[model samples]
Target: MKIEVNVKKRYFFALLGILLVLGGVFAVYAYNSNPPNPRVFGHTINEVDGITCNSGQAVTRTAAGWSCVNIASSGGSTPVNPVNTLSYFEDFIDRGDTSEVNHPGIISFQGYAGKTFGYIHSKDMFDITFLVKGNGTLYGLSSYESFYVGLVDASVSSRIYFFISGGNWQAGTRNGGSTKVTNLNTGVSIGNSPEWFKLRIKRVDAGTIEFFINDASVGTINSNVPVMPMQIFAATPGEADGRLHVLIDYIDLKITNLAR
Candidate 1:
C-alpha cells in the first residue's frame, strides 16, 4: 500500500466566503438603527405615542414593555428574513397573568383619540404584515364608541364611492340593497399602499379614512369621515368568514400631543 495525502483549496475558500458574509450582515445591523415603515418615502400625517411624525413612523408602549422587535428568519420577504415573525406586543398587569394577551395589539392614549403603528415584514425589509378577512370594523382617525364603518361588500353599489366612504371600509353583501355608510369612517380595514392586503386601520375619520398593510395604504374611505379617533378597534358585523385577524406590529395611541 502507498500513502497518499490530498489538500483541497475549495473548502478553505468556501469557509472564508461564509465568514465574510456573516461579517457584512453584522456590519449592516450595527450601522442602521431605523425601522421599516410608511413614511420611508417622505412625510406622513399621523402620530405615534403622543408624538407627531414629520416623516416615518414610531412604535412604543406604556408602563409595561414594547413588542415587535427585530428578528432573523428564512421566509421573510423583504429587507428582513422571510421567515421572521416577531411582532408580539403585549401588556400584562401581572407577571403570571395571560389575560392581557387578548388586547396586546391595542394601544391606549390619554388626550387624543388617534393611534398609529409602524411595521414591516420580510418583504423589502418589513418583518410583520397585518391581515384581515370578512366584515370587520377598524377605527383610525376616530376611536370613540360612536364611530365605525359599514361592511365589506364589493359590488356595483352606487353609494360605494371612493370619496363617499371617506377612507372607511364597509363590509357587507352588495347583493342586498343594505349598506352601513355610518356617520363617519370608524371601523374600516386600512393599509398604506394598494399593494397592502389584509390590513390594519390607519386613520378613520368623517372626512378621510385610511388603511395600511406593511405600513402602506391599500384602500381609502374619503368622505363624511371628519372624526378623529383616539381609540382603535376591530369589530365583526357579519359572519361572511366569521373571524378577523388584526395582525399588527405595534399600536401607538395619543392621549396627549407631546409634539404640540
Candidate 2:
C-alpha cells in the first residue's frame, strides 16, 4: 500500500512539471507575436507620427526621412500626365469696362484718355488673335495718337507688337530699351475706312515670331523676341482731339506648348 501511494505522488508531480513548461512556452510566444512597438505594413507604429497626408498623397518613409508622396486618385483610374495647354477667349459681351460700349458681339473704345486691355502670362509659346478697326481718320495725327496690339512687359519698356500709326501698320519689337520696327507694306492704305481686319501673332519656336493679317502671312521676326513674361495687350494712347475711336470684335489667345 505504501509503495503504491509513493508512485501516485511521483506521477502527480511529473504532470504538474509538464504543465508548467507548456505555460512558459506559451507566454514567450504571445510576447513575440504582439510586441510593444509592433510593425504595421513594414513600418513601425512610432515611425508614422507627425506625418500628414493630404488628398491624393500617401505617407512614405524614404532614406531622407518621412514624406508625403503624390499618388494617383483613389478611384482606381490610371494616372494621367499633365498637358500644358491653355486657351482664353473674350467676345466683349461683358468685359466690365465702364467706358466700353457693348454692341452686338463688338466692343468700342472711344475716349480721350488712353485705354488698355490685356492679360498677363509667363509662357513663351502662344498664339494671339484679334479683330480690330478704326472709325475716324488715321493719318496726320499726333505721334501719341496711335493704337497697338501685341505683348508688352509690365514696365512698358520691352514689347513685341503690331502698331497702327499715320495710316500705316507695322510690326515692332523693343528690347533692352532698343526698338526694331518692320512695316507690313500690304500696299493698302488704312486711312479712315471703317474696314475690319484680323491680326494674328504666333510663336511656334524659341527666338522666332510670325505675323499675319487677314489670314495672310505678313512677316516673320527672328530677332529681339521679348524673353521676359509679358502681357498681351490692345492699347491706344491718349488723343487730345479725342478722335481715337477703335472697335474690337474679339480677342483670343492659345498657349500651345509649355513644357519648358
Candidate 3:
C-alpha cells in the first residue's frame, strides 16, 4: 500500500509539470505573434498616420489605404530619373496657384501679384517635348513683353529660351554674357484667347540642338559648347499689371540614342 500511494503522488506531480510546460509554450507563441505597431522615424506618427504630400503633388485613396502621386511636375513626391524616358502631364483643372513646386536647387516663388512662373525638372535627359496652351493676357512692360519655355541651368548661360514677344516668336540660347536669338517664325500671335502650341527641343549629336513647332521643324541650334539641361521651366517675364496664365497640357521627355 505504501508503494502504490507514492506512485500516485508522483503521477499527479508529473501531470502538473506537463501542464505548466504547455502553458509556457503557448504564452511565448502568443507574445511573438502579436507584436506592437511600427512607428515612423523619430515622429510620433505610427502606422495609423494618414497620408501627406508636398507642393506640385497629389494624393488619392485606395482600397488598401492612401496613395500619393507626383502629378505634372518632376519636383513632386516622386524622384526624377532621366536615363530612361520620363513624361509628365497636367491639365491645371484643380488647385490653381496652390499647386507649386519646391524642387531642390531652384528658387521658390509661385504666383506673385496674380502672375505665375514655375519650373519642373528631370534627371539629365536632353531630348524633350514641351506642349502647353497660352491663355489670358501675357503681361509685360512696353519693351519687354514675353512668356518663355525652355531649359535652365544653375547659371544663366547653358539655357534655351523659347518665347513669344509682342506677337512675334523667338528662340535663343544663352552662353554667359551673350545670347544668340533666332526668329523662328514671325507674326505668331497669342492673346487672351486660348491657343495651343508645342515646342520640341532635341539634341542631335554633340554639336547641334534641333527645334520644332507643332511637329514642323523650325530651326536648329549648333553649339561648340556642351550644354547640360537641368530643369524644364515656364515663366512670364515682364511688368504688366494684368494677371497672366498658361495651361500646361503635357510634357514628354526621353533620352534618345539618335546622337549616336
> Highest TM-score: which candidate?
2
Residue 37's lDDT within candidate 2 is 33
What digit string (tens of lDDT, one per residue) describes model 2 on residues 1-260?
99999999999999999999999999899977622431111232244433434323444456787675543332122221111111122332123433212212233343332223444343456776767655445532123335777777777777777886556667766775654543454443465545566777887578778888878887888776667767656565444443444544444555532221
lDDT of each candidate versus the true structure: 0.29, 0.53, 0.45
As for candidate 2, its clashing pairs are none
For candidate 2, give the lDDT: 0.53
RMSD of 1: 19.4
TM-score on alpha carbons, each prediction = 0.24, 0.51, 0.46
Candidate 3, superposed: residue stretches over 4 Å from native = 1-125, 137-144, 179-187, 224-226, 238-242, 256-260
Per-residue C-alpha lDDT of model 3 across residues 1-260, encoded as one tens digit per residue: 99999999999999999999999999999877733332111111122133334333333334664454443333222322221111221222122223223211111112321111223232223556655453344442122354566776555445665776666566666654355433354344554444456667776656667777777777776643335534556554333332333333334555422120
Error of 3 at 217 (Å): 0.8
The TM-score of predicted model 3 comes to 0.46
Question: Per-residue lDDT for 1-260 in model 1, tens only?
Answer: 12222234666778899999999999999778554343221112232222321111122444554433223221111112111122232221112222222233322122211122221110121121233221123333312222222222223232221111444543221222435342333354443322112334433332444544445554565543322211122221221221221222232321111110
Task: Specify the highest-lDDT model's number.
Answer: 2
